[model samples]
Every structure is written in C-alpha cells, then in structure tokens.
Target: MSAGSHTNEIPRHRVLAKVEGPLKPGYETILTPDALLFLADLERRFGRARRNMLEYRQDRQERFDYGELPDFLPETAHIRNAMWEVAPIPPALRDRRVEITGPVDRKMMINALNSGAKMFMADFEDANSPSWANIIEGQINMYDFARDQLSYTDTARGKDYKLNDEIATMLVRPRGWHLEEAHITVDGRPMSASLCDFGLHIFHNGKILAEKGIGPFYYLPKLESHKEARLWNDVFNFAQTFIG
Candidate 1:
C-alpha cells in the first residue's frame, strides 16, 4: 500500500517488528496507525544511514581504545573556517537567562512548565528512565500542553495543577543516537529512540506551536561529531517540509 493509503491500520507495504512489551491502555492514543506509518516512513528513509553511523561509532570507539586520537576532518576544513552564524533566535527563546529541564512526569511537567524560568526542556533522555510508560506518557503530556489543556491533580497533596497563563517556553530533548527504543520496532529491528521521541513530539505539536508563535524547539543530546549534528539538521529540515 502507498504511504498515505493506510489511515487507520498498519501499512502492509512496510515490515514492522512486533512490540516487545505489554502495551498499556491509552498508548493507542499516541501510537495510532498514522503515527506508526510516519515512523515506518522515517525508518525506510533514514534507517540505513543511522545504522551505518552507529557502526562508525563502534569502530571509532575501538580505535580510541587502541590509543588512536581524534582530529579534525581535513575534508571539511573549509566549511569549518567559513564564517557563519545561526538565524535570529525565536521570540519566545530570546530571554534565555534561565532555563530548566526535567523528565516528563505529571508533577515535573507541571512544575517545570509553570516555573518562572524562560524555557523548560521536557527531557526524554538523561532525565528520563525510558520505561515504556514514561515515553508514551511524556508524549501525551506534551500533546495536552500544546493544546493548553494539560493539568494534574495531586490527590495526595490535596492540590491541583494547571499551566500558568504565562509559562515557560517549552522545548524537547530526544534520546541520543546510542539508544534504541526496545518497545518499538520497525522492519524487525528496534526503532531508533531518538527518532521515536523526536517524531512523535513533532508530529503532534509542531503545527500547534507554530500557530502559537513559539516553536517546536529541540535540544539534541550526545552528539559526538559534526556528522551527527548534520544528521539532526537533515531530520529537522525533513520534518519542516513534512509537517508543512
């Protein structure tokens, strides 16, 4: 079937591996048929490059263990020497004097977003334990937040939480290149956790954030080389085109 053909079911043209763990209720809300197809398309488009880069990382690690030091790539010296600066910062991110980050649990999500800080990164990597429940629930929290409907009720504390009218500008940090989401798979291989985190969040929130005059901003982690950065940039470019 064509990519757009399977709207409410898994696409037959792709070979998706079975999820390896128990899927909790409400997971279907985030891992819908269309979302899976989007992920499958990403894997088909970029999986080989991702695998090759991972292999390169392993080879580099072996060489490092054998006492080979690293150096600049002679091939890209001109690009490196060229003068450059990033585009102007987005309006919401301009006053980045204070920023906070934490995992995407209910309490943390409420606190971090409501914190007086200028920005809050809903971390899906270092601060997160990467359990299946955590990943899917994080996505849900982000989806709700984008729509200005996220809230938390703390019966234990006899308190309720809701977003402040003026809260921190939100950002997301996906899992590193080294991690794989064991719970999600495509083509009989574990899906790239980075892709899963980045894709799901962006698919759900990009347009909404854009409409709000903010961003679906991202904080990428554990990039060991310029190549990895380039890979992320490519993904960002593709995502912009795809989302648009």
Candidate 2:
C-alpha cells in the first residue's frame, strides 16, 4: 500500500490481532492504526527471514556445544581486506564523547536527555524490563521526547522536570533477536521484539526526527554475526523507502 494511503482504515487483510492488554492512557497516541499497519507490513516483508536467522543461530549454538570452533567467514575475506568507511556521521552524533543509557521512563528519560552527555540511548533491551506495559510505554515516552513534549512532575518530592534547551541527541536500542514481544502478535505468532520496537519508533518518529536535524539514530544490540547485521540493514533500508 502507498505510504500516503496508510490511514486509520487499515485493510482488514493486514490487521494483526489487536494488542492484548490494558493499554494505558496515551498508549493510543503511539499505537495508532496506521502505526500498526506499518508494523504488519514489516512483519510480512521480513518475518520469515528473521525466524530463519534465529534458527541459524540455534544451529550454530549446537555446533559450538559439540565443540566446533568459530572463526571469521572465509566468504567475506574480500570484504575484510577492502578499504571502506561508513556513511558520514550525522551532525548531531558527531561529538558523542559521552553517551548515557537507561530504560524508558519519564523521569529517567528527562534526566538522560538533559544530562550533559552528547547522546542518550533509550534502551529497550537489557536495561529494560520487557513487560507489556514497559514495552508500550517506552514507545510512548520516545514519541513525546521526540516532539519536545516530555516532562515529569514529582508532586510529593516537590520536583518538576523538563528537557534542557540543549538536550542530548536521542538514540534507541531495540530488544535482541532472542526475545519476543508476547503482547503484540502477527498471524498468531509472537512479534519479534526487535522489529516491533524498531518499526514503531521509526514509523512514528522518522520524519519528525529528520525535520529536527537529528535522526532515527539506533544502537543495534546482540547481533551474533555479519549476517544478522545485514538483515538489520535490509530492514532499515526497507523502512526508509516505505516511509518515503
């Protein structure tokens, strides 16, 4: 479907099961119909490959368990020897001397962004509890942060919090491939937590972040091999094209 046509009227054929849980207030802001459509599309396009890659990981683990040693891929010797450099770093990420990371929560996010660090990575992986509430609320926190509308007030502590005028560049780290988001399912199977996290964030914030001259910056985690990284690159390219 055309990007412009992805509205609240997501085609029934594309709908996954409605996210299962007591979705908290403001959850609707991030879990809109169009956003879910975007996620469904991602699952359709890449889900099989994700599953296969996970299986390959298991196979490798079995081989290692049998005492087979691991080494660099002979197939990529040319790539190893070739001179190359990644794309130029985005302006906002160039001076990342100090980067703070933490799980997503309003007060912590506010502090992390305002910390004098050059970058703040809001983690949905190891640092986070993967409860359904945490997963969905993390997305909500990111949405508000991207729009400069994130703040927290601790009435009992008599403290108020808001972003500093010059806040750190925000980056996101999705959950690893080994994890599944039980709360969101596609075609009756658990959704890849990595894709769910990545898709929702990018679909909701990609353009807005671009307009702010920052980015859809990401910190990929728990990749076991070059193949996994390649898969992620493909996912990123497809999402970029879809959004455009």
Candidate 3:
C-alpha cells in the first residue's frame, strides 16, 4: 500500500535532488548530467543568485588575483607615427638566413652587436650546453650587455642604453627540442635531459619584464606564421593580467 494513496499505482512526476559539498577548500562541483538535474532542483529550492554571472566574473578574477602576474601582455602594436622610425627586421634575420652555433661569450656578442650586419643571431641550438644554468646565464649575459655600445642599440636604441638596460631588442634562437647527451645538472648531479621550449620561456619572461614597467626585447625566429605571434600575444596577455 502507498503511504499517500492506498493504491498500487505510482504518480507520474520527476524526482529531483541537490547535494552540496562540505564547506572546505578544494571542493569542485561535479557537473554531470545528474548534477545538472540537481542544479534544477536547487533552483527550485534555494533559487539563483541575483547578480548576473558575467558581472561577478571580473570581481571573482580580481579576488583570485595573487597580484604576482604582470599587468600588461606585450604585443607589437604597429602604429605609423611620424616621430618614430619603423623598420622591418632585415631579410637576413628571417629563418635560414643566418647560421648559429656554440657556447658564446660576451666578447663575441659585443662583436656581433658592433658589426654593421643587419641581423645578428645568438644560437642556443648548436652553441653551448642548454642546461638551465646556461639558459639563465645566457639570458643574464644577453640582458646585461651595453646596448648603446652595440651597433643595433646605437641605431635603433638610444645612445644612453647600457648593459642591463631594459631597452633595445635582441634575438635569441634557443635550443629546440633536441635532447643532448649531457643533461642540465642542477644542485650538483645531473637532474635530467630534455628539450627546452624557449618560446614559452620568452613569453613568460617577457611578461615578467613588462610587469616591471620595462619593454620586452627579442626577435622571434623560425616562426611558421601568425600562429607563433598569436601565441606570444596570448602569453603576454595572460602575464599582464596577473604580473603585478
């Protein structure tokens, strides 16, 4: 016998239920088909929040912001201005135009920068062991050079630009996904051998730079097309939103 009705028949109605997680950190909502049905139930029981979801989104992002991410993503906004001179990278700078190799020292770089060559490439591919230490060192060395003393800097960059100056553009062709025999040794022993995606490194580092109110420098090489540029832009945008 039924409790509500003294009949063997059942009523034709949809059964619904809602479940909430225990109040704690790291609780994620399971949004299965069943979970959606439960959401409908919750709408019936507790009702929805008054604020429009989009309005709350930005606020939520702000709350989630650790203030560690950069404030602006870097992008080359080509605006034709009379005061500033515009020059496309020399044709020689394009992929396959210049050959690069070996562990480079500051003197060699200074020579390249001083040379009147339209393009100078610092190769991470053939040159030097691409261990993390080397990468960091290369970056520091690349970044520390006095641009004003360098030809590219004197012409494109201001005369005052010095080593460690946040001005001037430099091109670095980082070692690709080629694994070497000698792995990047960290802490003492060799930690691991792997490919370093310099593209990603440049993107994140560029943002780190931009967040510090500095302009990023670097000519991207071996690009297939606009895709790499778009990736760069996206990384920059993401970096800008958080790097504070």
Candidate 4:
C-alpha cells in the first residue's frame, strides 16, 4: 500500500475509504458515509493491535506444529489465581436457554428472529457465504431487524416473511478477528472483518436496539487469547464513546 493510497481515491470531505467490491443497488444505504467513517475510525484506533493479535495466533500455531505443547503461562499466574466475578447478567439475557443461529440472509434472519428459541444469533462468520452482496444486504437486514420492520417477499412463492408479535432476543456474530473484509479498505488496507461486521451493525442499530431493551448483544467467535478478547472490549468502549 502506498502512502497516498487512501487519499488518492477518497474525497477530502469523506473519510478515507475505498470500496473494492461491487456495491449493488441499495448497498449505499448500509454503507453510508457516517457508517464507513465509523469503520474507518475503528480501523485507525485498533487495526494495528488486531494485526498483532493475528500474527500471534500464527506464531502460536507454528510452535504447536513444531511440537510445542500447551502449558500455563507463568506471566498470567496472577490472573489464574485471582478470584474474579463477572458482571451481573442483564435481565433480558438471563434466560438464554436456547439460541438458534444462521446466516444473515434476509428471509433467514426474519425466520430466525421469529423462531421460538430464546435468542437468535445472526451469524456473519461461519454460516454466511461472505459475498459482498450477502454482507451488505445482511447489514440492511440487521438495520431493519433492529427497527422491527424487517420483511421479505418470496415473489415466486407468493409468500411474505416478517417478525412475529413475540420474538427472540437478537444477537450478532461477527466474523473472527482473523478475517479481513476485502470489500472496504481504510488506508489501502482491507478492514478487519470483525470491525466491519460489528461496526456497521452497531453504528446503524446500537441505539435503536438499546431503546428496545436489547443493548447490542453479540457472540464473538474464534477468540484465542485474553489479548484478543481485550481488543474487543476496547472496541466496545471506544464505540460507546464514539456513538454516545
């Protein structure tokens, strides 16, 4: 990447963002200027640490492949010995006995939201195709889902899909920290898929969902270390401060 990679293509008034993938019709709604700015902000704030974390994962994997056995780290003995308590579970999340999960396809998301499970996990990582259209349209679906106005028409089957009167609590599962969202780039580097997933949904719908008693719940997958988890915690804190 060149020093002027981002500046060369992006307008001065807008955040430095390069859309490498095809932006189909209506994708602009989800990839708005404000939302891309939010993503770029996240990338600027934590992108380096995220890259380091991925590099650490690779190093650990290589060591394991070379016959290095797993053992407790002496440096983290205090953490292992310390007695710690987690924050109290929120009332809305106390009873997550069952959660149904699927890709973030429009109709599938509607069906998952209306499923009888206690929670619906709209997965963007494992269960998704990760095509540009799938990812962007999924964001659109999430925005509408949070607003409780998500609907889909099966024109061929002549059927419509919508949320039920009583629906499950919703949770988003972003792509792992290891993944890169190749569609959009900040500073000529592809944005972290994790940030892209969490940033877009939270930037667009965090407050909307909060007003409905759900505080932008998420299920982070494939975290390998405390530092990786710490990165997410920092992202959450920064996002709250950014969007407050």
* Overall lDDT per candidate, in order of appearance: 0.85, 0.88, 0.39, 0.89
Which portions of model 4 show Cα errors greater than 4 Å?
Answer: 1-14
Best-to-worst TM-score order = 2, 4, 1, 3
Model 3: per-residue Cα lDDT over 1-244, one tens digit each? 5577675443322332222323222112122334323323322322212123223545545765856443332453453322586577444334343343334355566555445444456666556665445554454454444223332345555543223322223456654221321322222222111112232233335554444433344434443334344544553454344333
Better of 3 and 4 by lDDT: 4
> Model 1 off-target regions past 4 Å?
1-20
lDDT of 4 by residue, 48-111 (tens): 9999888999999999999999889899999889999999988779889998999999998888
- Candidate 3 vs. true structure, TM-score: 0.34
Clashes of 4: 0
lDDT-best of 2 and 3:
2
Lowest lDDT sum, 10 consecutive residues, model 1, at 10-19
Poorest 10 consecutive residues by lDDT, candidate 3: 186-195
Q: Choose the strongest candidate by lDDT.
A: 4
**Candidate 4's error at 18, in angstroms?**
2.0
What's the C-alpha lDDT at position 17 in model 4?
59
Candidate 3 off by > 4 Å: 1-104, 146-169, 177-215, 219-233
Candidate 3 positional error at 210, Å: 7.1
Which wins on TM-score, candidate 1 or candidate 4? 4
